[model samples]
Target: MGGSGAGGTNTGKRPNGQLGSWFLRSGWSKGELARQVNRRARQMGAHHISTDTSRVRRWLDGEQPREPIPRILSELFSERLGAVVAVEELGLRSAHQSPSVSGVDLPWAGPQTVALISEFSRSDLMLARRGFLGTSLALAAGPALVEPMQRWLVPTSAGGQEQPEDEPVATPSRASRLSGPELDLLESTTAMFRLWDAQCGGGLRRKAVVGQLHEVTDLLQEPQPEATSRRLFRCAAELAELAGWMSYDVGLQPNAQKYFVLALHAAKEAGDKPLGSYILSSMSRQMIHLGRPDDALELIHLAQYGSRDCATPRTQAMLYAMEARAYANMGQPSKTKRAVRMAEDTFSDAGVDGEVEPDWIRFFSEAELNGENAHSYRDLAYVAGRSPAYASLAEPVMRRAVDLFAEDTDHQRSYALNLIGLATVHLLKREPEQSTALAEKALKVAESVRSERVNTRLRKTLDTAARDFGDVAGVVDLTERLTAQLPESAEAV
Candidate 1:
């Protein structure tokens, strides 16, 4: 595959003094150079690339690499040297250089969600913003999440999920009504989309989910009888939440926040307290991702309080576990342990009394709960100033999560993430080789999944390795794979 610029013919190898000079200046080994180039290309949406040390050696010997490779190389050099290193600066002709890589505000409006829903749906359906993307999206804080959570809590308030019984309900006669079959189709389709999302992560089929969300939101614009409204809004809530999740997986934190608000609003309209709480839990997860454990804790508390009366055992387990994660990240061992026990107890009682759970909430199975709690322990081990007690405790729990993920084949994203968690546990165990091995396994699974969050986490683990293991060979090799990734992922939300 090594050749001249895209569609250009390869000439005989001539010594590339220009590339060699920069190579010396940059100080990376050839293998390291190839790995970094491959990583940068993947970020640029070229995952099929396989640039090896041999490829880099050839490039230095003057076999001009393919179009994007030379451009990618130039960018890497620029960043490394802190200057605008052009393609030609790397001794490659820029005649056919690849081009450089380059928000919808649908607010809740009007008396009810009709105008808001209609506007969001139409705009989203018509929206097509797919281009080469490299985002620095901050997960929203303050009013972004707080206002939505408040609205969810007070269902009797304006634009609240449920219409107050004391008020006259408007069931518009001219509204386009959904038939039972149509409603069922939407429900089934949403479920199908969710299954695909579970297996593939947030990057794949994201547009399809947004499309489904649009349809549901559009239907929500038409006024309907109370029963009809409940069903329609429930579908909208589920779809919107799924869309938010997909966006979150792809690292579009701000966009994910908007979708989460839409889901919360839809749940408020349906008066589906449990579902609304679920959405809050998701927001809380986002907070944790953003390193705002305090915010994460607050969000979970709100969700728990709002759903206290009616949450199914599984739902309670999920929320409690989410709370545990927040506490773990905060280095609050006692509180984290307390919350974990609650999660375990609630999870044990999930189906004991024949309580029916929403199909969506049913996903919080033993494996999922195990994975969540494992993450909590892992965080306590590392995030809590490297507490050895928790570090010792994390390995076994994390291993169990990995085993469970292996048993559950359908949850590919979860499986991949749990593998990462286990690898982290190995990292904490001071077993650098073991950690590298486990991380390699995790990364392989991550390749089939399109979630940028997974890739980000992989980078984080490697960064940790670089800090902790110093000159360890395996750690060095793993670290070089993405050393140039994500300075902007740290931008404040």
Candidate 2:
């Protein structure tokens, strides 16, 4: 609730209650005004702004915004009122905008989104604090997710759009114009980064990935032909998606979500429906991990709806597999099975020859599908109270994934993850010896990678094994070995 005082009550106030008068005339509560300001700040890339009604109340009580916020509030009001609203008119003292600060507000236009990504990438790469990279912040972003989803689903026309007058525009460098060679370089760089992420995990090369994203951002400012620009946007989109995944790998969920949204916007600007769908799918995967299965389901369905007409069989298979995972998490066994079946059928229909899958989705091989199914079954088993039958069903697929992933160095993390899953299955079967052995092996492989996900999985495996078979000699030995070798943070139950 917001306090409302009539204009006549403070006609000759010293603080000049113009802001409050405007607030009352607009019929917006203090909380709503704070939300609007915070949102606008995000759009302007102010990463640390966390305003609430209390802050708004202070502003009404003659407390002024620190910096850049006054400018932001003026712009927000200007757009809403369809007239010029200067900083002085907002009854706030003007201050210099902060340098090197980036926020994660969703931009409506494609160009603005690109600029936002460019600035954020550069800031993320160089800034020490990286305050917006917190996993907890990302997990709590359900409300923030709605606006972007709506914008993607029902795009606004160019005519209805208004650019913030205070936004800093970058001048294009003549020497930085796009070329075929530059495009090739960007594409190759993206591929290299993807391989690095897959092989070594995101934490090991996250800074490098962010640096590369900054480079791409630099390229994005240059002028180019329409066709070349579109291709460049697609390439940049892929790189941004990889950067997002790398951020996720390092447990920087908020940063990951920002990059993912940037990638989505880039994909849309490029008119690459397949890439956009993949970006959405990636977002859904993150949501699923963050314990928002219903939100994850909506994003996955939106991807399917947008890409259904032109998505390749392999892409469709991947989307269905993701849906199955979401449903499994939601404890909807029937829907989970149905999505899994759809994925299987779609993959089966993907013939061996003359089928050109996008490079980004080429990872969805038979082994990947098997791994996805194994994960779904594992989730279902958990939902079923760790039933031995479901565990048994998961084991063979996990074994297959282990062997398949082992064949590719880029999939070492996946192989290790599958080993953890297999060990869990063994634990469910009360095979302490086998479980300890598999978990030990997984831990060894995980040690060579820098994935937080693999670390978390290994910790869970050891915890489960120790809880069930602490007295067993094999379990004791493995537990001691893990406690000595693993990080102190991960050694905790």
Candidate 3:
């Protein structure tokens, strides 16, 4: 909880000129400084620090405050300065201190955002472990979700600032104009990563996908024709979104949020409003899974507002379906059903005359919609007074999803998830035998994928089966077998 630096300790003999200088430059009175520090401390969940002008005077007189106060001061100055104001800069070094994450605070501008994401990718790649990125998922629900939504909604500068010109523009080369082949490679690679993630889960190849992101960053630095540049930005946005999805799947919610924010910036640069809306929708989904249905609802509203005119029918259907999910989580069956109907109607309209849909939304087919509906029904069954009718409704839809996924082997992870959903429905229906059989099949399929989401779902299903029918031999045997297959951490869950 101490600061970091190589500064000599003043024995409270003379005034600390550095502290006084920063304090003056910050344009805050001593009392105001103390009050701001106390407020920020409380927000960070630190022990309350009673402060006053007298305490500030003592600091100015070369009397260093106790542990944690220096760190708090560093943070406050950093925020005010719009730059990293280290404890060392504040001349408040201490011997015993806890470590802190190397924070990145980028402005919500165009090229700066690109630099921020590039630096983030490099830092993330170099770190041997997740470090601060491994923090709890609950931490992702607050500003991480709100900031991106707000930034996306706000207009930047007039004339719509162009993306950064390729570096070293004085020299003309192939790097000055991105060729068709480079764009195609990027698009195909993104598609391949998406497919692999759907089939095998993100845990297996997440780092490799991130490595591709590093390559994309290099491409972003190169110049291109106006059309090619737009396409490149769009491609970068899609790849970043995929990285976010993989990060979420592997239980790295905070890292996932970073990737999503980057995707939003790239989408905006590309002038792809619908793609930006889709990224917001994805963020909403993550919020919903984190049990913040209200936040998720707000994000969906933003997505709808931003893309009301531009989003195609297919994308609109997907957004409405997400809205249904948020409402279902909030236990508003009436609103949920309304949203679902809207989604269904829009989807039907999109199908007329074999109308082509955006490639990004091609995965939201009837089967995907059915699966989404089944999940909504399942959530309603649990939260809406445990309505048996909803449970009954979920079963057949989930069955259809399972059957659909079974036919498409490339979505084995999703197929396993559907099986888990169906098994839960059976358990709700009090059919222990069917539940046990379905749970076993799900576990077997899930074993092939390295998804924390699938593992978590399987654990939940097993927990449900054990609670309802622990004494039944079939249920007990199935649970034990599944437990044996899972990692120790997941098995414990």
lDDT of 2: 0.72
lDDT of 2 by residue, 356-387 (tens): 77678877888889898888888888878987
lDDT of 3: 0.73
Runs in model 3 lying further than 4 Å from the true structure: 1-106, 128-138, 142-144, 158-177, 351-355, 489-493
Quote the positional error of residue 175 for candidate 1 in Å: 8.6
For each candidate in the order shown, give its overall lDDT on alpha carbons: 0.72, 0.72, 0.73
Clashing residue pairs, backbone N/CA/C < 3 A, model 3: none
The parts of candidate 2 lying over 4 Å away from their true place are 1-105, 128-140, 155-176, 351-353, 489-493
TM-score for each model: 0.73, 0.74, 0.74
How far is 160's C-alpha from truth in model 3 (Å)?
9.1
Q: After superposition, how far is residue 342 of candidate 1 from its true place, in Å?
A: 0.2
lDDT of 3 by residue, 257-289 (tens): 678878888887677889999999888888777
Off by over 4 Å in 1: 1-114, 121-127, 130-139, 157-169, 173-176, 477-493
In the range 1-493, model 1's lDDT, one tens digit per residue, is 5322222334746778988999999999998998887766555555557787777877787776655676677656754663445566677864431211002223333234545544554444444342322221223454544654664554363443455544534455554467889888888898888888888887778778877777666666566666677788888888888888887787555557667777777776677889999999998898787667887888899999988998988999999999999999888899999999999998898899997777788678788898898889889987777666786777777788888888887788888888888878877778889888888787778777777777777887888888989799888876765555334232111
Which scores greater on lDDT, model 1 or model 3? 3
